[model samples]
Target chain A: MAKSKSRTEAPQDASEDVVMQELPTSHQPDVQDDASMAEVDAEDDAEVEDEEEIEDDTQRVRLLPGSTPTAASFEFLNEGHTLGNALRYIIMKNPDVEFCAYAIPHPSEPKMNVRIQTYEGTTAIEALQKGLKDLQDVCDVVSDKFVAAQKDFKKKSISS
Target chain B: MDYDPMAMDEIESKGPVIKISQADTVRVKFELSNADISFANSLRRVMLAEIPTIAIDLVEIEDNSSVLADEFIAHRLGLIPLNAEGIEELQYSRDCDCEEYCDHCSVKLTLHARCTGDENMQVVARDLVPSGDRINRVLGTPIINESSDGLGPLIMKLRPGQEIKLQCIAKKGIAKEHAKWAAPSAIGFEYDPHNKLHHLDMWYETDAKLEWPPSEYADWEEPPQEGERFDFNAVPDRFYFNVETAGNIPPDAIVTEGIKVIQQKLASMIHDLGETEGGENGDYNGPRSPEYNGGGDGWQDQGFTTPYGNGGNQSAWGGGAGGTTPYGTTPYGGAGAGNGGW
Candidate 1:
């Protein structure tokens, strides 16, 4: 049932051909995750008490089966860096953005949440990506021009 | 270190696709297939460590009679994020050949505030005059002070007869070295296709499956949408990034440069790891022994079991790290026979 029949049938008694025919080609060194490989997320009660001190890390935010492919959001802890007007100014420039806004929900926690919404044809993320790209372009142009102007000023100053 | 670059499809997606963005805050979502938490976390790490920006590095206080100490004023000067307009022209002080600093490696900002007469004026970032006509000319406006809309956040109040003279040094650096050097205030990501959680006919707010990030949707109390309990696409591999900039270099530059830097680092790592540990650590990982794969037990999963071969024997190598050449299966492509074989 082999497609390539003319690959030369192994000589009946040839050890080299015998070894070649039995060679395993998809060798993957198994990674070790003692905790995970031992059991899945839903802990089996009988074997659950192994790592008592280590807190079980429960992950959320996964788009499970039967979930909508519509939207996504994220929260970032403000480490004292909130370029509020500047970032908003940049994101709003994108034409594909259907809805987007940033808000600070907590007074105690230094955090801000930014939500970017998109139209039917585009996803919310793509709009943010486009906006980010635009910002990059603007920054790059500014960087290049600043350098060029610096060079010009240096050259002119030296001659005078 | 154990990441499989090939298994990631989020890297191949077209757009992060902005969904909703408010002034100063934006939410973006993208997809990733066959990838995990490491992918998203790595981007955050890169933004925190890789993207370069300019900030005040050194401050020489000539005279200070203000309430703040000399060290405090210097520290304040260091926190100020300058206009990273001509950063491409600047080099890191660590990389530059100059002994201390030059125009190519650093920018100088000098501030001399003397409260003369009777008026007690506040010495602010605007009062700090940046030198180098090149940077100032391109900036067209104040480098750091005027751009950021706050009077006291980065300002120092001075009273009458309180004189402050200082020379500030600006240099290129990444956030990894110091928080003051970081470009982004906050940057994070999450798996996309945000589906609703449900239990016993009741729609829950957050999912418990994905770790590192709990349901971001749970944080807000918004009106439920139609079919919140229905799942359209269960497996979402999209990567959503929320980046808040610190206001100098912007967010997009941070994202683009972060990815580029991470790629460069990975490529360098591969190159560095490819060579043998022969020069110094020869004994630990010297030439391979002939009996290394003696029993041939390791060969079983080396490649795919090709049907074209005689019997159920031959295993053709599939694509993997460094990639397998099209010669059936064996890890010893170059090290075969007498070629570095012991």
Candidate 2:
């Protein structure tokens, strides 16, 4: 039965291979036509490129099933030096995204608040989970230094 | 002491509210009563003061209490928010002994004279004159006789940046400076600051599921202003917004495409879960539908075992937990026409 099955598959696979191999080579004349039709085809190619990117992303996503993704944000609240540093980091990391931002002057506070928006697409629930995990990792790496900085900012404000 | 121009009892027949639409024309209104003639003359001098207001287009408010309004008032009070450094440099040389004024000092003069007299001002620099010579001298002082009871008029001149330091001259009933002069010099509307966050609010409104702020009403009501166009393409599905300011979190940032890919994978898994739940028959236990091989004859209910052929395993394609293969023997198709006779 297995021999018969292999024999049945062999003839069918051979025909498919022949068809696949000859189709492109047989269309050699079409290549010149493709060149002549380049401008219109270029637009088609761009759309195809976009689809290919999405397809690649879909394949990658399928491999990591059930994994949550999160967004990493950098806030610039009053500390110009830290903000400049954070902005530099973002620019370095996400060169493709156009960053839109503006400053809001705090009524009594001595400094301005700079708000920035970055575009990313991951569901909020997944993003939240990832964000929490990232926060944990950040906290661990700093060895509670992050907490200490917050306390310092608070103390400075209160003391002043 | 200038009379309050905004005071209510002042008008005999209120003058038409002269609305100035032309950008070039300077509009000055004297809300003076028929009795207050001297105050009207004081306004002309204040208008001539050389303070300039700088216009900046801002997006958000740091202070909503209208400090800009106060700045305007202070302008009327003769205080000006200095323009850039160049103008400040110019103020130092408006009045000087040199034919071409130099930085030692310039005398800025604002004269509010209604009583009809010429007041020549002398501002002597320390370098040009000795210690006793440094003085702010009013050349001609006008004196009204006793029974007239009315201050014949008022006069005050000022240097740029210097406040108009003139008191209201008034008799028992006749008040002039107080009735016609503005308390603060208001810079034109160009310098008025606006909110920036409204830009985001408009973006949200373009596709928002939730309501934006109250200011959005005015924005929606008005036509599009320059540099302000709504971004209609930013869809809710394509973005995830968070209130980073509310918590001690990072500000708005977009995750990378890899993160979205992970999200799509998870979504697919959920879809698969639904499909598996739907495909599962009532065995209630065992590997799920995608893995379950229920007595495969393709017609196991009809009492045949091994759907593919003799001695073949009941599992389709015979692998443990392999993903569903598309060309598996469909349970609906009969093996042969003679096998299942309805």
- How high is the lDDT of residue A91 in model 1? 56
Residues B195-297, model 2: lDDT tens digits: 3323232456454434444432233223346888655532111011111111111111011111222233334434433432342243321122122243332
Give the runs in model 1 whose Cα sits over 4 Å from its true position.
Answer: A1-160, B1-35, B117-119, B133-153, B188-236, B274-342
How much lDDT does each candidate structure score? 0.49, 0.26
Interface RMSD of 2: 28.0
Off by over 4 Å in 2: A1-106, A113-160, B1-23, B26-106, B110-342
Provide the global lDDT of candidate 2 against the true structure: 0.26
TM-score of each: 0.45, 0.17
Considering summed lDDT, which 10 consecutive residues are worst modelled in model 1 chain B?
A: B304-313
